[model samples]
Target: MGAPGTARRGPVGEAEYPPLSRRSGWSEGSFSEMKYYEQGTSAERWERARTFFDAKRYSMAADILGGLVEEVPDQVGPRLLLARAYYHSAQLKRAEDQLRVLVERDPAEHYARLMLGRTLQRQGRDAEAEPHLRLASALAGDFAAL
Candidate 1:
């Protein structure tokens, strides 16, 4: 009982995030978390995530991107999309964790650092966010001087 061809059956099998009920409006039924991850290769899933994101279905994108990030942890794009999904969906801690990883892996990843700073600020950790924000502005090099 899933939306069209979305859910299938398979993965690490614990609920990584909440169910897909929030994204389901098709009257076809809800998606199984496993089906979401198991139905596609990494590239397919990445495309699905992007489509979901562009549609503003952040949770759905997050769901697909989350598994893709785990399967290809070295791929910055999926992880960045996952972080954006988390941030947009207000899953602040998860977003921070992902952005922090990106920042650490490539200290010059200014966009990630900017997101990390913003996530921290959202969590009311402005003091901790300042350094990263400053660094982001510096790396970006065209912002109004902080």
Candidate 2:
């Protein structure tokens, strides 16, 4: 066992455990085998995901956003983007789940509520979606929607 402040080294001197202060990207194997979206700093990965999303590569964007969402679970931006990516990719169930989480966290989140309602509607659950859509409209001050 190594000292409390030190990581145990592998036979060739590689760190067995990354230091808590470092933000190492997650990987299953060697660096070369890591996915492109998983190979950069969080900011870089975020930009990459955004670029993919803008290009209409929703599945690829979701692939990157999924990891980002896990890494920054408390960040509403990444979670929202992930949900959008899922929605664009026609992954209604996933989009609904993420949107539900956001709405649960902030009941006044108009965009999330709107997305959740749309997702449910896409899944042929119009009756279940009406309340959320109404609430979202109310939150957005669209009284006509009510």
Candidate 3:
């Protein structure tokens, strides 16, 4: 017979079998707790940041957006808006860096690719700009004609 409370293993080792419910730390209440935790705080931060950006206070906007990005680094909207603020403030190199990260994270974002290409063109780096423009054109398809 096997050891106490131990079941015989199949093709795999004993550890390979699914654990009993008590063995896992999770309980049914964990999801509910997470949902409740995220209810209103994030929305409030986003609204405040958007208002700052709309006021044309680019430095303040950058600060707020930078904090937001740090809190939620994977959020595309904050990154895009931060890049826009940098561009409007004549921080072309910072804008380019932000858009480069965005494009690398999401290659399918044609708008980001196009904007990056245009920024590079403005910086007089046509060689570096060409590939992004081409990618954007391909993604935009026939609509690129407009």
- Models 1 onward score TM values of 0.74, 0.80, 0.64
Candidate 2 lDDT over 12-123, as tens digits, reads 7764875322245333334567576766888999999999999999999999999899999989999999999999999989999999999989999999999999999999
Candidate 1 residue lDDT tens string, 63-127? 88887888899989999999999999999999999998999899999999999999999999999
Checking candidate 2 for backbone clashes, the offending pairs are none
Instruction: State the weakest 10-residue window (summed lDDT) of model 2.
Output: 19-28
The residue ranges of model 2 lying beyond 4 angstroms of the native Cα positions read 1-28
- Backbone Cα, N, C clashes tallied per candidate: 1, 0, 0
> Root-mean-square deviation of each candidate, in angstroms?
11.0, 6.0, 14.0
Scored against the true structure, residue 8 in model 2 reaches a CA lDDT of 60
Clashes of 2: 0
lDDT tens digits, residues 13-49, model 3? 5454432243553334444553322224566757776
By lDDT: ranked, best first: 2, 1, 3
Candidate 1 has a TM-score of 0.74
Consecutive 10-residue window with the lowest summed lDDT within model 1? 24-33
